[model samples]
Target: MKRISSFAFIFVTIVPFVGCHTSSQNVLEKKVEVKLEAKNNSNASGLVKISEYANGEIQITGTITGLSANSLHGFHFHENGDCSDNEALKAGGHFNPDKSHTHGKSIASTEYSKQHAGDLGNILSDENGEAKIDIIIKVPSLTLNDENKYSLLNRSLVVHQDKDDEKSAPAGNAGKRILCGVIKS
Candidate 1:
């Protein structure tokens, strides 16, 4: 009986410590890259990287090329990760997990609840048809953790053919989806 009790105590103590260590590993920094592909025969392709910073801030950085020179294009995250459609319509509309807010500009100044969580504003291409993406805004609703309801994993990243008016209803008057990529771990 004594030997059994000793083993039981060791198991109880060691199991909790092992569990805590495993969970801590999960809280570590996570990073994922999405490879944007051309849609509708558009010449837009790029590699976008999403990473979590020290202060729990998530950043998106990358470069897109083959865009119209000196032009602006709408960029956003969609509800689905499927980009198999030629027009990328399978990705569905902007990711609005809350389903309460209207479409609005996703900028640093915009309130978190006022804009759709997936509204990422625009991407501007330079003279060489390349747009360097470096968005480090504070989007509290957007997270990398899959357990969070507002998580961006397994979603679709889409590039529009035109600019986002930032005040439109459903979508910001952004043109057809020209490029698409799936955000994954």
Candidate 2:
């Protein structure tokens, strides 16, 4: 009887945790892939993996190489999915469906705003021209369906040659779109 009671208690305590874990994984069943643009037609390239979480948060994790060392690069999502243009101008402006002037928040800032959805602040590169990126974005909503404006799918990711000044109209004074990649599920 004592053995049976102990087993019952352990089972009850662990079951809820197991269930919650499974449920969360089920919610994040969607994922997006990003392919960075090459420079000078060389072998320079990078890729990013973005995963959508249960609570509508986005998990963006990537390792980008072939970038300038000890520099700050502007990272953002663009309106169009096209990155074919040499300058990636085909991606158009930022992902500002709301038409708000609220620019990107500083990476260290915790304040929230109705700013452009594509403004993801900046990405810093190490001295070796490499960057290990791991960040989360809590957008209003994200769906795999392209019809949804909040959907990040079919969007473009851009890396600029300069650091994002963090406060500028439209695109944050970040000069030259260097790398471009389309977000696809």
Candidate 3:
């Protein structure tokens, strides 16, 4: 009986790690990279890496430097992947494939009740003008494949000059675009 209990415990622990990828519906190895660009006189640059996990969650991690130093800046994924111009308008507006998208938190009552799929809120830089973001988007709103209209592939993430209130209509009036990056799979 003791041996059987120990075996069960090991099996349970190892199962998640071994069969995790097979259990998910999306591609686990699919990843996107956004190389940030500094707009105008702003001093900010970084690379944001986005990947899908086994639990249908999106994982974003990266390092940014040359922010306002200990300040909060709005960050989000924008439609279009082109960052060829200065104003960053080449990247289009916030990524909202559906008209039902709103401005709210990622975890809202319903899929369309919250905010734009691209709305990722804010990231605070340390006093050294550097910010490191490592967050797991637990919501199923973000996807890597074409099955979901909210797929983050071929998009670009733009950082604003100010903090996002997370309540304002559209994009929370997050000020000017300080940096932008194209999301490539």
Model 3 per-residue lDDT tens digits across residues 43-72: 889988888876677888999999998999
Q: List residue ranges in candidate 1 displaced over 4 A.
A: 1-28
How well does each candidate superpose onto the true structure, as a TM-score?
A: 0.81, 0.81, 0.79
Over the stretch 1-185, how does candidate 2's per-residue lDDT look in tens digits?
Answer: 99999999999999999999887663675777798986334334678988876676677889888888888988888889998878788888887766754776742244445466777888888999898888877664555545577787878888888888878877899988888898887
CA lDDT for candidate 1: 0.87
Better of 1 and 3 by TM-score: 1
- With a 3 Å backbone cut-off (N, CA, C), the pairs that clash in candidate 3 are 102-115, 104-115
> Which is superior by TM-score, 2 or 3?
2
Tell me model 3's lDDT, rounded to 2 decimals.
0.80
Cα error, candidate 3, residue 57 (Å): 0.5
Q: How far is candidate 3 from the true structure (C-alpha RMSD, Å)?
A: 4.4
Could you report the Cα RMSD, in angstroms, for every candidate shown? 9.8, 3.0, 4.4
Model 3: residues with Cα > 4 Å off, grouped in runs = 1-27, 106-112
* Residue 75 displacement (Å), model 1: 0.5
Poorly placed runs, candidate 2 (over 4 Å): 1-26, 39-44, 106-112
Considering summed lDDT, which 10 consecutive residues are worst modelled in model 3?
105-114
